[model samples]
Target chain A: MATILVADDFHENRDVLCRMLRLVGHSTISAANGQEALDMAQEHRPDLILMDLSMPIVDGWKATAILKTTSDLRHIPIIAVTGHVTPDEINRAISAGCADYLAKPVDFERLLGKVASLLGDTQRPPFLSS
Target chain B: MKLSIRTKLLAALGLDLALMLILGSFALNQMSAMNEEATFVAAQTIPSIDTVNTINDILLSYRNLQVEYIINVASADKLRIEGEMHHLEEDMAKAFITYDHFQLDENERATFEQTRAGWEQFVTATHTQFIPSNRDSNTGNVHPSFSRLAPLYDNLLSHVRQIKQQSQQRATTALGRVRAAYDASRLVILSETTLTIVVSAVIGLTLSSNIARRIRKLRDATMAIAGGDLNQTVALRGSDELQLLANNFNLMVASLRQQHLLLAQRNTELSESLETQRKLMSDLVQRKQAEEAADRARATAEAASQAKSMFLATMSHELRTPLNAILGYVQLLHLEAQIRGNTDMLPDLERIRSAGKHLLTIISNILDFSKIEQGKMNLEIDTFEISSVANEVIGIFSPLAHSRGIDLTLICPPEIGLMRSDAGKVRQVLFNLLSNAVKFTERGHITLTISHEYHSGKAWIFFSVADTGIGINPEQMGRLFQAFSQVHHNTFHHYGGTGLGLALSRQLCQMLGGDITVESETGKGSVFSVCLPADIGTVQATRQTHVLHTNGNLPRHIPGSVPSLTPGEETAVVASPTSMTQRDA
Candidate 1:
């Protein structure tokens, strides 16, 4: 299983995301805000990072920018999770160093697919695994 | 002299000639009268003196004969002689008186007076002797009387002789005096005739010469004036009124010369001023024309600006509709790939879709802003249920909100009426607000509230989206509704939205005579409100209240079995293993 980090300010959203990741047989870590997520990323060095864009202390855009520029963390793919997925917002995420974006209440299947595709060589279990 | 001066001079000469003629004629008339009177006196005196001398001679002869007859005859003869003597005495007395009164001057008067005395003595002696004898006797007495009277006759003859002598003397003296008087009268006639001739000749010559000289001067002056030499003055050399006339003519010519010079100068000035005025008028006309041209150009430029804005709006609409289809299909494809476990193409497809969508949104914003500038955006008003619209917008956003642990809620009063507005625009506005709430809120609830009120006989529908999220600052609020404006600089960077939704919503509200407003505190949350007019006739059914409960407390997903790739496999496969392996690679 590929190790992943999920950063979100809301507990319910984090729980739901964690449940979906476990169903697919991926090990996941959770953080409440962008700063916590950054600390978790540095500490764990997860294969992929799932970022919630609107957060206290540091937003997903700043966190992504800092992570992409850091030498040790630059190779990790970052995906933005947001509620409003307008074209301008998607482009902004890409420009801010996110590998891909998913609009929130994110579809379980789509999220799993994006995580799988961004991970490339990292094998993960199917999302519907019993 | 000028013409008038010459005229006056000639008139004076004419007057002088007339006076000379009158005086000369009067003198001639007096001289002729004197000549006639002298001729008449000379002829009458000579004829009277001859007659007197003849009478005196006859009287002397008759006196001698009468004396002889008186001495020789008797008394009868004496008496006859006495009668004859009386007659002779009367005759002699008349002759003596005539001779005395005929005296010429001192030289002729003495001879005439002596002749008269001798004649009177003879007459007296004859009368005394002849009268005495005639009274006595006849023939005898006549003889005695004749002898006595012979001596007396002789004496009388002597007195007669003396008388003849005196008569002769008187005659001679009278003749001499008459001759002298005739000589003096002839001398006077000759002197008068000579003086009349000389005076007439002198006056005629003087008058004729003066008139001729004046006429010549007048002719010369008239010629000079006709030759255009107006400056030349005719010299008037007389003290007559002709000099006054010449002075007046010179004054008239001077005045005419001054007037001519003044008139020429005035004409030149008038022409120059007219030219200047004409130039000024033309300049004014040209300036007005230029101003009119500029005004026309300004109007044309304004018209072009309006046309350009209209073109942009139409092009944006035409372009965005197709872009929407492209992006929507691409998103669907990306989701389908993930569900099928074919995730290798997901990243490239998402990139292409996002890039297209981003360009599309920029085009849409530019078009919308242009439409607003041109005042061409209009509302499509329709009647719709407020609750239904709210539910639809909420449904679209609920999944997103749920994933973020944001509680999204809809609060519509059961008594709320159906709203009348542009349903499409209202939906767009609500959808933007609700979605923004869901995106911004992380741990807090987002609510869509709907209410209705009556004001001034019109139903007003008020809708609001409130969220407990990171709210906007007051400073950023002013720019919140401007096109392409984001509340926070990082909003576009973090949240994915075009940023044109709020601006378009505000424009839509303004079209419907309504507005959108916001109330928020930073770090707490935000509430965006929209007020719209409700349709009068549409009625909404009252909502039924129910106690909603969920058995699993977790959001449910569709539970149909996942299609398996291998028929014999017991576990439901999400995707083919080979495709999953290709995605992982």
Candidate 2:
């Protein structure tokens, strides 16, 4: 299992994200804001970061830019989570340093799929529950 | 003479008068002395000589009468001899009295007195001694008496002769004194005349050299001033009225020179300003006409734009609101299908969402064009990385191009940097261009070049999209940017576009203070170049402009005098053979 950081300002959204990761058999650490996410990711050195765009106390763009520039943190893959996406904002996120992105309310299948691929997990798993 | 003609003439006259006075007085003194001498000779010398000669002749006549009486016998004859003697005596007395009328010397007076006494003695002897009655009446006796009377007469004659000689000597001496006085007066007159002539000549020369010369110089200076040569001035000579006149002339000329210079300069300035004003007036007239034309156009545009704004306002709220609701419900259904683990409904929900999004895109494009036409579109300006915008536009179309078997690439030369403009508008335009490129391009490559040019202090960023695909013909290209116009009747059907992309893109480019142009040919390729105005405060112009292709090969050089590109610009190639259909993101 790969370690992943879930960053969100909303408690429910963070819990849901963390729970989804745990259910996929991946270990998860949760943060309430972008700064907390950066601190925790540096402490734990997670394999991937799921960064929320809107957050208080150092937003996702700045935190992502900070992390992408750090030589040690540069190795981690990041996926942006946002409610709306425009070409301008997309370019901003990409330039500031996100590797991939997903639109929310989170599509767990796509989210899990992107994480699994970044972690190099070749074993396929059923993403949807009946 | 106070350095004046009047004074000099007076001086000459005065000198002449003085010379005349000297000559006249000398002649006057000489004439007075000559008159004295002539009067003395006439009154004394000649009269004294005549008295002396009269006494001498009277004495001789008395002696001869005495001799006659002595020889006579009658008493009456003797008596007549006595009377004749008395008459001789009386005549001698009158001659002695004449001596008193001359300027006589003492010697001449003494001589005259002795002559008168001697004449009286001779007369008595003749009357008494020679004719005595008691004497014997013999003739021999009369001879002795006559001899005695003759001796006395001879003595008186000798005395008279001595007086005449002395008087004549006095007259000669007076003549010599008059001759000396005449010679002295002549010498004085001759010398004074010579002196006056020399003085007059010298005064004339002085007048010519000083006053006359100064006057000539003043005339020359005045003439020069009249000829517009203000530099000339009179050189003053003597300190006099003429000099004062020269000084005043110099002052007049100096002031005139200043006025003349000022007037000439003012005249030149006036003409120059008049010419400038004339040119400016013509330019203003032309400008007024142009402004009138522009106002007319603007008024018509504003009227049409008002109508367009009303339409766009109705469409945006009416259309976008419902479209958003539709997309929202489709997205909710998509999420619902995932949550329920309904894999069968997921694709349908996704299709619904995709269709909604397509419709949204068409609606958005139409709205954008309507906003532009209405002049309601405004740029929200900010600073953003142009390269990143370009990259993002390219990135969004890369998968589509890859799916179509097209090679996609982007290049932002290093010389370019951040731009302060409406990034969203740029992204929108680039999105339209790249999407159109990918949508039309089926094979070969798609290139998006980002370069900048600096000209006349303004920087322009050029984003060009060239594609090798189903190209447009020359006939269809003319209507490319018309709203909702398609290249062919079936182009919209085949390409699946609202055909508003290029139209909106061109208008959007104009919104960002630039323009969009296109080049295309049938069965070949097409290029859409969107030029954007950029603030060069933080951007450097690129040295070479190049188009990015998947193989790092530049697109064909444009049809103009544009210089060739450098070999060292950076380009990102996406030869990723990804497969994407309407089903995938």
What C-alpha lDDT values do all the predictions have?
0.63, 0.70
Q: Write the per-residue lDDT of candidate 2 for residues B316-387, one digit (tens) a residue.
A: 435543454455456555655777778799878877876766776776666555555544455677899988
For model 1 chain A, give the 10-residue run with minimal summed lDDT: A121-130
Q: What is the lDDT, from 0 to 100, of the residue B37 in candidate 2?
A: 85
DockQ of candidates 1 onward, in order?
0.02, 0.03
Show the lowest summed lDDT stretch of 10 residues, model 2 chain B: B576-585
Q: What would the per-residue lDDT of candidate 2 be over residues A33-77, giving only the tens digit for each residue?
A: 988988998899999998887789989899999999899999899
Model no. 2, DockQ: 0.03
TM-score of chain B of each: 0.44, 0.47
Which segments of candidate 1 are over 4 A away from where they belong?
A1-130, B1-58, B64-78, B91-113, B130-310, B324-585
Assign candidate 1 its CAPRI class: incorrect
Which stretches of candidate 2 lie above 4 Å from their native place? A1-130, B1-3, B71-73, B131-142, B149-152, B219-228, B268-276, B279-585
